[model samples]
Target: MTHRFVFPTLALALLLAGCTSLPAIDPAALPATPAAFKETDPRWTAIAPAEAQPRGEWWKAFADARLAELVERAGRDNASVQVAAARLAQARALLRDAQASQSPQIGLNAGALRQAEPGAGGRGATLVSAGAALSYEVDLFGRLSRASEAASLDARSREALLQSTRLLVQADVAQTYLALRAIDTERAIVGDTVEAYRNTLRLTERRVQAGDIAELDAARARSDLASTEAEAFALERQRAQLEHALAVLVGEPASGFSVAVAADTPPLPQVPAGVPSTVLARRPDVAAAMSQLQAARARVGVAQAAWFPNLSLTATGGVASPEVSDLFKWSARTWGIGALMSLPLLDGGRREAGVQSARADFDAALASYREQVLVAFKDVEDELAALRLLEDQSQAQARAVDSAARATALSASRYRNGLVSQLELLDAQRSELRNRRQAVQVKAAQQQATVGLIRALGGGWS
Candidate 1:
């Protein structure tokens, strides 16, 4: 009994001695964290906000409850977000599979059989056998460990992707809703302008009938009326299209969805610009890129592990006998254990190729991560410039609208007092109408710029 147990123990010790753990890898070599961007351009220094709220409901800065509600709905129901979530689940399952490879596996077997002999009369010889077997491959060179690490990094990357997609969907929903509101405002303005032109045309016709104004003046007034009416029709079509787009963004059928148009426009939201380095942590795309780099680095370890030997231990126990009734007797009991070592002595440079491929992939991932960082910085810079310039433009447009209003008032008063021709009044009115429409456009652009800045800053992912 002592001898029987001693050999099994010695074999087990040798098996353990043959197995080795993976070498540690340095984390710093993967990729350097991005630094804060410093802009020497006067525009960035002048317009950059001193502080920012990088958290939930960034749209609430506009103080529009409707807009906030729409953003929330889209974040919850958007198909793109659903797809990202599914991909994340798949990555996690893959990670689980990789981790499972690190442990031993055990299974059970049980069966019964009968036998016949040629030299004797055939007889029923029932045989019953039952046993359990275990098999395990020791990761002596860290292959399994590196594979698990890669899988974990892949899961992290997927999670970051999901977050990024959610932010984009939220931004899209808000922008589309804002567009629909802008169209509604334009439609109302055009409708009012069309009515004013109609009244002018009626007055001009009466003057022509009274022989105070030429038929030519009446014809010009009628032409202006038709043009304004056409503009109104075009604006209506644009408004419908914008509404349909918003409906689709919120994952609703376009036919049954329509955004309610309020008489008041939502104020532009205030955006605070934080430090540039904050984007690295806040932006999901940046995080995903970094995770990808980590996964690639792990792949290098996985490839290097192939240069070492693989160790496996297998054990089996069962009972056998010529007669089925004697199968369970101690005389028929048997057991065996074995260990295997497989070293790649030569493979026609296949292992070398694997190592080279993994290194190349790592290099590519490093470059991609760097590019993503540069692009993120560019997005923030562009948005900063746009917001600053658009603010000045909106102010200038406001002044133009005011001046045009004054000109229209003067022209209308002069015409009523018989101090100016009806033609001059019509021209003034058209200018004021155009200026007002342009002002609305400028305001919408300012709102959009604010939205862009928020999105570029990763929609407050931090």
Candidate 2:
């Protein structure tokens, strides 16, 4: 009679002990966000959090068809994006496995045995049994629940990382394609300069033959033509390298892939700036970090719950008989049900170590999350500042190019009229070419900075 009461009393004790709740996590421990970014534009307006929203066709804002196509191709085929997607799939599968642990496990069992009875000497008997068993953990200390939550958060983190990878690939494709276009513009400028030098060389050679100018002037003109041609070749090499990089981004063989030289680079698109909080919420890296932190927090609870008693309920039903004919009889039926409560009395400090390790992971994840937020803010500020300064630089470069062009035209006419020497005409020509190339370079910087701003802002303002 005393033994009959033991199981119920033990179960009651375990249930009461499980009433101990996990400690609450403080949200205030995270870094505080300001209402606006330090460099937020006044024209910027409040927008909804866009992390969950699709950044559909953000590259189209540049109004370049080829760029949009390349970005879309990179999004579909980039190796980094594919790897992140595979990781996300694995995380989801692990989440399903964790959820399965919370559900009852059912299994079928069957066995056949042949054994000799000691009293029967040489006689052998056959026993056959078939059964179904059900087992379930009671989750008395919320360990299973917390484990599932952690798995779910891990899946979310992987998903956010995948989005971040896609965004990165898109930005890379746009920047590379824009760079190639800029090289094309510079190449055109150099090609024109080379032709102009060739013309100057021919005029100098004719004047030298007629005894109007010395051989020295023709030698200088020849040197200028060769150097300008060499510069054009350098631009060609850079354009080829950029094309190869773009091909790799789109998952194509570099040897066979090429982007046609475009006559014009795309105009820089205006990217709006919103509050820092909204930008943080929209960035996938920040989302991934937050998920990691939450997952770590859940794991901490799971580790703490490990110190509590675990309760499991099990049931089995089967039929057993000495003969096959008797196996189906009602008298051969057998059924059993049991409840178990287990608590570790000694573990050589393993439980305490697990709790400590989990807490440490939580702390590390918290730090990582904070760092990611700070970096995200820094990226936005850096790009904003770059675009602002690059715009002013581009305008100033344009003025310089115009002034150089006028000086070169005047010097060329004076040289033809014998009012200026060949060296003066060559100097003005060199100045014009340098200023024009600089203008193209500044324009390219502006385009790249625009793309950087879009990427830093988490894809698009929309």
- Which residue pairs does candidate 1 place in steric collision? 126-324
List candidate 1 segments past 4 Å from native. Answer: 1-54, 112-128, 208-223, 273-280, 318-332, 346-348, 412-418, 421-426
The 10-residue segment with the lowest total lDDT in model 1: 43-52
| Candidate 2 lDDT (Cα, 0 to 1) | 0.84
| Candidate 1 lDDT by residue in tens digits, 31-95 | 34333435313223222211222447777777788888888888877788889999999999999
Model 1: lDDT of residue 33: 38
lDDT of each: 0.77, 0.84
TM-score of each: 0.82, 0.89
TM-score of candidate 2 relative to the true fold: 0.89
Q: Write the per-residue lDDT of candidate 2 for residues 73-123, one digit (tens) a residue.
A: 888888988999999999999999999999999999989999997899779
Global CA lDDT of candidate 1, please?
Answer: 0.77
